[model samples]
Target: MNKVKILNLEIDNLSKVEFLDTLQSGVVFTPNVDHLMKLQKDPEFVQAYSVSNYKVCDSQILLLAARLLGTPIREKISGSDLLPAFYTHHQQNESIKIFLLGAREGVAAQAQQNINLKIGRNIVVGSYSPSFGFENNDLECQQIVEIINNSGATVLVIGVGAPKQEKWICKYKEQLQNIKIFMALGATIDFEAGNMKRAPKWISQIGFEWLFRLLCEPKRLWKRYLIEDIPFLLLILKQKLNLYLTKDYLKKNSKDKRHSWHTAGKY
Candidate 1:
């Protein structure tokens, strides 16, 4: 299981099907360009990703960048897509209990209801929507831990948002019980609950999912999509150029050495 080291993160080079087959029972981070950009400037964020058991490329932008950098990833496994696929795959596996955590209060509850109706009712055992900045409040965080633990769920889908979800899992993993899998699934819950409409498959495939999201919620997402993520493309281009130069230099060096060796032999 090799990882494609991109920027400050090492994303697992795995396709959806391959990754699903070998899902680890630990903290998982599905990082996109914005998350990766944060990893550059934020130390606590770095610490969170550092402790993550699995880092999957959840952005087509990253997937395309990896390919351009000559370290192509297997596939893009966005959280929004993974939730439904995971539920569908494990539909009959009643033993695989799930707990949904995060979102605006009652959003997770709605997600649970939607999932039960659409995906499978039996798979979701528990769900909770934590208050904003709950991670900073030890008592509130502890309560969440206890609720998820007592629910006897095997997987915990955390959507409190990045860095926070990662930091929470990284910091309080020891307190959690029964929950075997922890996934930082961003807004997958909202999408699942029918509160948000996901981009069309064609849009996602063509790498305009971000644009679709921007159009959907420009007020919340404009800064992130425009200001924050613009540099990622430049970074990717820099890596691609550096890679190209390094390979060209190596090839030239090999050719020069071969020519020198031939002249010496003739002498």
Candidate 2:
């Protein structure tokens, strides 16, 4: 497996370029600290990630934590970067049809338009914004699934944010027969459409993109970053310590085996 388990979640250790180039048609899960934390308690989220064929690192903070834990990921292949790059390069390939799902009412449509404009091709075939808690309503979920199936889209970019987007994929991706790839893109669609801005490159590189976002949307994000996500460091440390102990155990066992072999040879 080209993966490492940190805090009991499997992370693919592939670079951004490699991940994009080889990205197959399946659930594409991008988990940051917030998501990994949620996985501890949310069986649906665990099911979502467990079934993902592509599990790329979505957070620079997560990258840093991995490096410190002795399981360095190759790179961040976040949805924010993946969505635009995928369209920019693959839009010319007519076989790859796309659908934008789960932004605000008109935002997914706006993103579809912007992407088509930027790519100079109409790769996006459909756009839909499911209402809040629409997944809770079985009829609504089936309708959304049917709309996607009828659109003839090969890819579906979902921007409903964390657990909801992931849960939607877990429950409905297999039924979306037309969709080859399902991306839980969070706010990336809004960022792509100019409805919101992503963090600056330097800020993102330094692993403070969370802070930048928190500052930008303080009311909605402050508690997430400060309270919920801060405790994630403790989780990281615990994993690191566990990894260290395991390595030490392996080394000690190997050494003991070698000594026993030498003593047997002398006898």
Candidate 3:
């Protein structure tokens, strides 16, 4: 698959369905680290964002991070590479107003301040950190929608961490019409606020970014990487095998169907 452009974001070819599906069904899929590493090597995988709904799989998000880290714009880059890219893009082109949602109390404020300090002025249009576990409340969700809509932000960056962040974006993408791009960047706020440490360049380049993160926050992330990462990789492999088999079966079936049509016409 080739990369397609959607609203200032470059998405890899393998993710077209996932991106489109998010637009229609609001269900975003998360891609693994390996796919992200592969995307970085392929220039054709770059995408530009427009007015359409853009949903980036997890792998694509990591690839964006890698690009920013490899080309550091400022001496002080955020722990999560995603923030630097977002910040850098905004700094270069201040045409878009951005909204920050979903971080610990004051984390968004800290991030906003950091961006202002780093970029020499405030680029963030609005920043809000909902109460702990606010996703569970319908009112909170509505309030968030209202805040974003009223702020007139073109992009909304959510840092609620996965599954929640992904789910929230999918669920609310429609209602949040003012925002052109909605990115669910996990823990990017903390990283930007200097609350966390990003992996070293060598670790990121070697695709050991996850390992570095685990070492830094073992108590929180050790179980996730140690237990979930392997199973996740296995599942992705299974999906790839299934796709290959399906493609072969479809080709064979089409050939047989053509033959059957020819025979029937002859008879």
Candidate 4:
């Protein structure tokens, strides 16, 4: 697979591009916003997937990914970048076939309908609502995999929430090898499905989407947003500080052969 490059982001494989292009052709890419934010502070996390030829980016990356289809370049972007790309792709009639998975009962269907209303009909291929704890069931897992495989979907968007969605992709990657793009979209399916509401555009722009979500589901999300998020931020800060300190130390101690000349030859 060829690598696609856009700005600082690089897509290592063309399989996803080819698949989407052949199916929907010009659909915008949408990824998990939270994951994108995490990647900004943790390049290692981004690189881990990047090296695997996976483009784990947000909306912006999706936009760039759409543009680089069949082109020889890398695709890298964020959520903010996807809106415009979607519009452009829509105008070009190159939309990709999307499959929405996860979320509450009927949420996937609702999300698909909403996206179709927003992006147009046929943009979404299908939607499925799995068992609440589908991840733990091997039989259910195989069943879902079979459904996805038979769907001939170009992009399979999993919204079963984190770690689980990620784990599912890792476990089924081999079985779904024919799948070009497999995104673990976390709550996006729920948000789209209307099971949850997304923050207003202004709030999202200001990076307060988490706050809005917490406001909507205070009892369920307060701990995660207020407590877990804070510690996560702190950990990110610590990691950054350590990286800076390490770089500074390396620079300070780096060998300078010119300054270490030996003058003891005469002795």
Candidate 5:
């Protein structure tokens, strides 16, 4: 399992085909520019990422950054793309039962319906759309867990958002003893449900999908894309010039060293 170092995270250096063919059972977290920026100051998010089995590149900008830094990633495996590929790849595998969690009301259900129709079978067995701040309510979290458990789903695809989605999975994965795979894919459920349209292939290829999203929901994503995440480019420049303090970043993450991403073994 070779890895490409991108700032604080080490992304798996696996192509889409390689990953889809080999991955069996483990947690997957796709890191984008916003996620990287959050990781800089969000200790809880860092802790959640520490326990993940896979951290793959989810942003085309990150992929380009990797190339600029002289260690190119094989591909960009965004959550929106990964989810569809995953379901289609395992369409015939009866054991690959999935549960859709997150998105707005009815979104996950709609995604389940669409995916089932595409696969010609019910690959997505269950769906749930948690309420606002549902993660903070212990009882609600437990009830949702039970619902997923009762649904008999082996794979859990959660898409509430970053940090929240990752942290929730990290906290409750143990309780989900029946689940074999956990995927924290932001907004993918919406894409599958057709509630949101993805950027055109050409736009995505040029690494401007963030602009497309910002254009779509300017009020919601402006700060994320234009304001808060601005430091990512400077950090990439620092890395390229060998000015990034890797030691300091590692020291910040040292608290979670006890958790090993490879403990469950690779596919």
Candidate 6:
């Protein structure tokens, strides 16, 4: 698997079909700009990402960033698209039973029903919607593990949110002995349950899906799109100019404000 380096991570440079064919059962996490920014400071999230078997490009912004850095990715495989593709690709394979975890109350169950109906079989064997902050509760998490294990699911699709979902899977994956594949796919369960709308293909193709989402839920996403993630473009520019600091150098000098990032060595 060829990879393209973007800042602190190497994204698998595989097309949708190629990725589907290559995956045999391992951790999958889609990296976008927000995730990239988080990786810069969140040590726990970084560790979770380090355990990922496949880190694929999940944003057109990242695709453009890769192209600007002279390593163009083959495709943008967002979780919204990948989930549908996975079930469709394995429609006839009985060994691919899936368990969905996340979304609001009752949403994961609805997604299970919808996906199984679409696949014409019970490809999705179980679904659970964890309460808010459930990741912090050891007892609830244990119950969730038992529920999934008892369901005989081979694939676990968790979609609560980014670092939480990724970190939780990394922490408890071993307890669920039956799971072969673990995917931390944000908000895909909501989309699958028809609780939210996705941007049209044309908008997504033109790299405006973020803008579409911003307009749809300004109150919930304004900071992520408008304020917090504004530095991604500058970081990409630093990479293009060969001024981005290597991971070790950044760690050693992280507390030394005098070491200018603009004068840093290559990543």
TM-score of each: 0.87, 0.88, 0.63, 0.61, 0.92, 0.92
In model 2, the clashing pairs are none
Candidates ranked by lDDT: 5, 6, 1, 2, 3, 4
lDDT of 3: 0.55
Estimate, for each residue in 127-200, the C-alpha lDDT of model 3 and write its tens digit. Answer: 99987667678898899999999987787878776445655675678898877666666777777877777677
lDDT of 5: 0.88
lDDT of 4: 0.53
List model 2 lDDT by residue over 95-148, tens digit each: 899998876778888888888888888899889987766766789889888999
| Residue pairs in clash, model 6 | none
Write down the worst ten-residue block by lDDT for model 4.
258-267
lDDT of 1 by residue, 134-222 (tens): 76578988888889889998999988777677777888887876777888898899888888899999999998999999999888788
Compute the lDDT of residue 135 as modeled in candidate 4. Answer: 65
| Displacement of the residue 72 alpha carbon in candidate 1, Å | 1.4
Kindly list the per-residue Cα lDDT of model 6 for residues 37-138, writing each as its tens digit: 767656567788888999988999899889889999999999999999999999999999999999999999999999999999999999999988787678
After superposing candidate 4 on the true structure, give the runs of residues whose Cα lies further than 4 Å from its correct spot: 1-95, 243-267
Best by lDDT: 5
Model 2 misses residue 46 by how many Å? 0.9
lDDT of 6 at 105: 94
Q: What does the lDDT read for residue 29 in candidate 4?
A: 31
Q: TM-score rank, highest first?
A: 6, 5, 2, 1, 3, 4
What range of 10 consecutive residues in model 1 has the weakest lDDT sum? 258-267
Candidate 5 clash pair list: none
In candidate 3, stretches whose alpha carbon ends up further than 4 angstroms from where it belongs are 1-30, 33-79, 92-94, 236-267
- List, residue by residue over 23-118, the lDDT tens digit for candidate 4: 332112333334433333333333334423345344332343334343433343332233224433543454356678887778889978888787
Locate the minimum summed-lDDT window of 10 residues in model 3: 258-267
